[model samples]
Target: MTDATLAQLDALPTDELRDRAFALARQRRDIKFFWDLFTHVTHSDDNTQDGWIGSLDASIDDAVALWREVTGHHYGDAEPLVRAAFIDYIMQHGK
Candidate 1:
């Protein structure tokens, strides 16, 4: 990505940046983007639990919470890397 593009994306709020990338991914039906998103969210710090909740209902809630946490920019220290990846993806495919 060009410096100008990077600068422009960086200027956006994290939530906005993520939303744009996600919207583009959805529009293009980009499996790789979704896969990467799943990987990132699952590998995030809070998801290191060894045991499953066992209940499908709880699991669904947990999944929803995880998505909200990450997309809401509450990803803690990983926020910068996540934002950068979103920016890079947008630069690469947002034409």
Candidate 2:
């Protein structure tokens, strides 16, 4: 992802970040893509113990950006609003 995109996202507060992330997750198949990439990245980071929302803004940004780049071309038929709610669930309750 471009620095500008990251910068734009990073500029938001946590609540807004949550809102944006949930909105982005509303994109078709976004949750599948995010979790697919997240699972892979987490496995790759197995040497380290990481948790939700990441430890740093850059790290979280990088992960999201990378996931987008890697799997953005394919989105399942999931409805925008549904996955967005899922993202909100993850943001609110995921470990």
Candidate 3:
């Protein structure tokens, strides 16, 4: 991608950044991207306390939260690194 394209992508709103990266992942059947997203979300904070890893329901909830985040329906704003992850993924794969 050109520098201008990169600039444009960087210039997008955080929600739009998430949307574009997510749409690209779905369109390409990129399971790795989704996995990466899941990992990023789950690991964003110290959510591993109190047997967080042992519950399938918790995992599902996290997945749903991730979906909401990507769809711009999340209750809270994403973290800086999570937002950077979206931009970095698009920079690497959207080119």
Candidate 4:
């Protein structure tokens, strides 16, 4: 995702974010990578960092929502569990 796209996404409401993400996920090979990076699952490098954060820089609200779905826990509510899962995903994927 480009900073421009992230800015566009950040401007959307949570629901719209989810809908757009899912819809794009279906067609985008890198959507999951972006989602993981945004949610802090994987290490973000220059190739993925700037745009990974957001077009205009933004909050993790939408990322948190996606995290909940991916882990079945409230966003950042279970700190250790969330961190563990985030790290585990990255480790398994070798990203």
> What are the Cα lDDT values of the candidates?
0.66, 0.45, 0.61, 0.42
| Worst-scoring 10-residue span by lDDT in model 1 | 52-61
Q: Model 4, stretches more than 4 Å misplaced?
A: 1-8, 31-69, 77-95
lDDT per residue for candidate 3 within 2-41, as digits (tens), equals 3426677778888788777777676666656666565555
lDDT of candidate model 4 versus the reference:
0.42
lDDT of 2 by residue, 6-89 (tens): 345444554454445544555433545455445543453454334642434444345566545543523244323334533444
Instruction: Assess every candidate by TM-score.
Output: 0.66, 0.29, 0.58, 0.29
Clashing pairs in 4: 3-55, 6-55, 7-55
| Angstrom error at residue 79, model 4 | 13
Estimate candidate 3's alpha-carbon lDDT, on a 0 to 1 scale: 0.61
Off by over 4 Å in 1: 1-4, 44-66, 69-72
- Model 4 poorest ten-residue lDDT run: 86-95
Q: TM-score for model 4?
A: 0.29
